[model samples]
Target chain A: MLSKAVQKYCVDTLCIFAVFLFTTNVLAHGGATIENDRCVFRSQGYSIHFTAYQPSFSRTKELCRVVNSLSETIIVLDFVDEALRKLPVDLILKKQKDDQLYADYMLVDERIYPAGTMQLPMKKIEQGSYRLYVNIQELAHQHEVAENVHQIAGFFEFTVTDGAKEKDQSFLARSTWLFYLLALGIFIYLMALKYRS
Target chain B: MLNANVIKKLVLSFVLLTISTVLYAHGERNQEPFLRMKTLHWYDVEWSVKNEGTLKVNEEMTMKGRVHFFSRWPQVISKPDTVFLSVGTPGPVFIRKFSYLNEVPMIQSTGVETGKSYDFEVILKARLPGRHHVHPMFNVESAGGLVGPGIWVNIEGNADDFVYGVETRTGQTIENLGTYATANVYKWHAIWAAIAVLWLLWWIRRPLLIQRYLLVKDGQWSTLITLTDKKLAATMIIGIIGLLIYANGVTKEEYRYTIPLQGGKAEVDAVLNPDEGKVYVKNKKAEYYLPGRSVIIDAEITNNHNLPIQLGEFTSANLRFINHHVPAAVAALDEDYPDELVADSTLVVDDLRPIMPGETRRLHIDATDAAWEVERLSSLLNDPDSSYGALLFFYDSNGKRFISEIYGQILPTFVD
Candidate 1:
């Protein structure tokens, strides 16, 4: 039989472990995701196909399909740095007819509509650098069909200086696999500790 | 002396570190200044009983504390579009009565910036009594993300039977949560506070230590008296009283409560031109489920004017019209539209062609091979009054606008 002190120590450790697990459950909130990387941004003026994924030697046509479908997909974009976002800039979509297709203009300024692919043509914007932001408002309702209303939001880095080369769209791709892997590893370790104790 | 000073320094550092660690571990307190300042300061809260002396379960109104953002300092750098106003519930724990941000209905997701004061108020109906902390939360779309600070409010009961109705100042009855009652609840708290103070005082003043005396006996039966041991007794008595008083004060301050609502309402006229001519209306109802996600819409179209209206565009929210003018595209029993932007759910339109005068059509649209999931009910707080309902814009032969309202709930469902 263990001594009283040892048994007391074990009980204390178990209690602490239980509290930690309970708290972890509460703090681990859900998040949003974008399934693919290759996307197309189209408006009346231009339809540009941009690939944000690595071309693997392995056959991954299914992966490519996932990337292609993300063109019109809305994402929840958050500003990482406050100081960078405070810069005075505007995202202007210059109206141009690519292949002679007329585009309908939405009257709201600074608002990007993801109703259809390609941003509406921006007109008469002040010269500056800006990051484009797009988001869809997800509504709440009860019917089962209302579940797929994920609002597609997009962000693009643009500059308005004369003769400014449009910033590479590749700048938007981010690798969060490391963070996910770290979180998963920690989660597994915690689960193992919990089960063992 | 050097050693003693070193020891004192070590003890002081240890105490400071303990306090700092406690404060730092409390993440909820430091998140956002707005959240810290604008907690619903609930005081003098009361719940009145019904005719049978049993508490009225469904008819309780919670007047949350009036909350206002700090009007000065550290100006909110982002514009109104960056921030969002939100309430803290573990889930949709309470049916929101009427919530106003800065005295205006919080209809839009875009929120108020910093340095601008706002009063938020919500009369909540009685909900399930899980100890939930109600707090103010802000979401910045791109810049300065979520700032959430919370306060605790304990509730105890089941939530299913809760019902809320509103009675406007004009006596117009609209279903709403009950009003604020402060006096009754605070009375109980005040009584408890006084009792605690008394108990603390009584314990301290109850003669903690007995005085002793050592004396030489002058005679066998004669009582002998000598110098009393007052030094240790004095210190013990004073220390105990001081500790008790300090503890009582600390306890009173620890349970300090403050809950305020910082919101308001706005009444603005429509900026867009209203279509006054032909009232082309479509009242369509639809249900969406995640398994092979489908939109089953029960549709009805009505032409109120003498002239025939052609609905070339049958749109729901932001989804556009496809083959709406196609004559051969018959009124489908179940027609599915491509939702490329947001997959999994399909947009169902009743008829692609125009309806005749006073004609009603029913159509069902379903989308297969789409990956769909059930959305949370909390998003409804964004558009509470259903003012931004589904619209069907029709046109006359001359291209004048005819707007119709589609009435139905957009529900979230699960597949697995």
Candidate 2:
């Protein structure tokens, strides 16, 4: 009976976690998605297709995600939204830490680009974990408050390992805290309902 | 102990917050509020074919307006010296044929002065057929594209009849825009691809897997590459090198006039115009956005001039709200006639009472237009700090024009 209850608890927790993931997908594109064999990040109806090629390393191979290769990588952002063509997009790649957006944590070179195909200068990064932030700002209207600048930012996480393995986790493993709360609620409700008789 | 009600409330709050964040992901309107605030202010906005109206495909239309580079230009952003007047519709919804700044053909980069209003006119050929939101965009050499108010344009008809032809100065006609390349790159790329495929096929034709297995098993595995194959590969490599050299020499001769692009920042004056004593906006506030989609602003106006002037129009962003009565006819006889008053009409403004000069008077102004919803002005919605900037145009009895700036707190209107 104890074993069965534990199994039910685990299943319920996982299911709740799945629901949380679906909700928080608004934050990011469930981390990211591969479209047309390329990594495309979609959030808030805006799409930015990401491509990273090690021209100094391999000419034909396209690697979007950082892996075991400690190479000088060339990252390219092919804007899918036409609106992005006019907006100024700034990219910063630095070590993952709190206040990464405001702090001068930029390891790679940074400059605002006119938004067509922005090819960031090739960067030679040592093998480690890092986060890439793409900050996009569009022209605000004349009536809008001039002091407050609203920005749309996209975050991508990557890791450089000795030998990186593939990630194929269940929904429960990759979800927000809301999902666990939902799962726990459902589990409690079910337990109460089952014992009421 | 958390009760079920508390838990339910918590979950509901979480869901609402998540939805709010998703729905209001900040992009254009909210990003760089300072840039939008201090940059050029667009006024006298007019679309040749009225906005939200349908037009036949390939129809030529113009969007004419004025941009005032104020004295309050920020020093943080790139100096706005060399600016190009540009128009964009989501993407390439229309083909821009000609653009004029103050009646000067401004396709190439042009310069504008601070505290000066430049009249912008763009002639667009509707190559695309659909409902498109077109905006007046300005491109700075150092800075990026600064997009203005967008108007919805519906282009009708089939795409087959759209012709994007430009007559060259030398009497040559280039019909297709995309096919203006000089070199026949496609043909050369195809030939190279074919050569590579044939070269790969030459080696794959022989089923050398079984032969290699046999040779390895029999201990005579050193015979994989024959002498003839090596000689042929060497000759082919030498031939490729010779072809590459010949191609480079031939192309260099074919395009001898080609020059590298010279792109650098331009220097222009940020001259601020001395303020001539005119009407000043004092104590301004927007009461509400009525059901008909109009925001009413109660403003106190002080006419500094000697003559009594009437508030003719209030333009915010690209939306126009004109007075109904006093000057029933457009002041086309005014110095800057068609450029300023073409888009102005008496049907927009709510009141037309004249405010006496040197006297401070409170006037309730109603900015009524469908553009409020289309532009998604937050002042009409329920949000804190929805303050906006507006250009108030005052007119004397003699049809003389005097413009003033209104910068004050604007709060979102909530209906009871």
Candidate 3:
């Protein structure tokens, strides 16, 4: 009977561990997949190559979504299509709080970029979850004029944190601690049962 | 005489070897996303392989494309001050006959300006027999190789039967440049390998390390090297020098009219303006229906030309979707071109009527195909920014073609 109970306990623990592993795997590969070896952000029939850099903190490294440092962040959107250069586009930076979005920064006004490149220098941004939206001004105008027409735009989500310290508080990091505690608890319970026997 | 375990192990070994031989070609997806996206954007790439399904030895293929040096080049990589255009293939599988960028020969590295597109063409001849993936690539000065779309080509026949012949400027015909001086290379390598083996054996035959250290500690290190060893070393050094002098004399006598390899970049003229037709296309809205596997784009097209025009083709990321109704676009597909990239279903226009001269009309274009999903381009719907870009070709009544660019956000609809 004792051996059967131990087997049941082992199976239960393994099942829980599997669930944890599966959830973390999904989270890691959740947003923004690489296509043709490129991190492309598509806006209605057009695409832009999105890249971020924290030059003051990590000059040589190219960042995608996470900004490790609180320093001035440089975000560059490269137009993959020449047609995008002719359209007027704007960008908005918003922060998420309690499922509500609040505008944090007006990164760009509606303007045509002839060079096919838009560089946004962000400073004084607090640590939080933020969304950067690229709005095509022409499409936005059409949306306003027509009812039931959605605005044509694209957006990417990123998290700003206190570098390594905040990274340790992430779900994956905290789950690691939980995993160790669970294992230790199991080991201690087994030792107690062995002593009683 | 073999046991059951031995037979099992043999079977396992065979399976492993068979699996290893089924390797995939082109590891382009292994590169960092930033480098592939923000560096050089390749567009309108067209590859033509002669006898594509089974190209015989010595047959030729061509890859032509346009590469736009992205203006927003990544800061992590150095600027492409000097770039060399080359072909990417499994080592020496195909020999590059000629490579031209903007009609100028790309024998050496050349500087390119950002925000400009350069037309390039590369001709390659099959050398090895097997399946190979070929890509048009550019090697930046500091940055590594930036590759374009890769196409798989199959070569049949024996590799040994392949020959590359060339005619020198002095009107001398070299029978096979590929095998030229091959025997001399093997002879020199054998001679050097023999000398190295003799030298290694001479040292290995002697009591090494501890024995020599003990002699040194006893102040009898001089005994470690006998007079015979010194004489043999001197003789070996003299023999090497003599061989070098003899080889130099033989080479000078055999190739008296040798010319040094040409260096310096060839001057290429500025990129010519592509003849974009007077037709203009404005994207009203676009959506991709998931269940139907189709992309529906609504746009307003204006015809400024004197003749009425009809939509001919929609091309994106080297994939061509032709309008079957337009004979001109369908005729453009070469017989040797890969059929997998072309959509089986023709592009559908809501209104088949051609827009008259000086008339603007709203057109709904439906590009439906399993190719969108097969090419993995439909994954754009899952991307954070779901936008797409495509070139629309308009053909006039006289078969004159005009090009217009269309770009807009594409939303995915679950319900068709």
Q: What is the per-candidate TM-score for chain B?
A: 0.28, 0.62, 0.68
Give candidate 1 regions above 4 Å deviation.
A1-197, B1-267, B270-285, B289-291, B310-350, B365-389, B407-416
Chain A: TM-score in each model: 0.23, 0.49, 0.57
lDDT of candidate 2 over B182-231, digit per residue (tens): 34788778868987997888788877788888988999877877787788
Q: Model 3, which residues run further than 4 Å from truth?
A: A1-197, B1-55, B59-91, B109-122, B130-156, B206-250, B274-292, B295-309, B325-327, B348-366, B379-389, B405-416
**What proportion of the real contacts between chains A and B does each prediction keep?**
0.00, 0.02, 0.00
lDDT of 2 at B191: 69
The deviation in Å at residue A131 for candidate 2 is 50
Q: Return the lDDT, model 2, position A1.
A: 40
lDDT of 3 by residue, B299-405 (tens): 99999888999998886654567888988777766655555456656888889889999999999998865445434456566555566767678888989877666
TM value for model 1: 0.26
Compute the DockQ of candidate 1.
0.04
After superposing all C-alphas onto the true structure, candidate 2 shows an RMSD in angstroms of 23.1
Model 3 CA RMSD to the hidden true structure, in angstroms:
18.0
Best by DockQ: 1
> Residue A70 deviation, candidate 3, in Å?
41
Sort by TM-score, best first: what order? Answer: 3, 2, 1
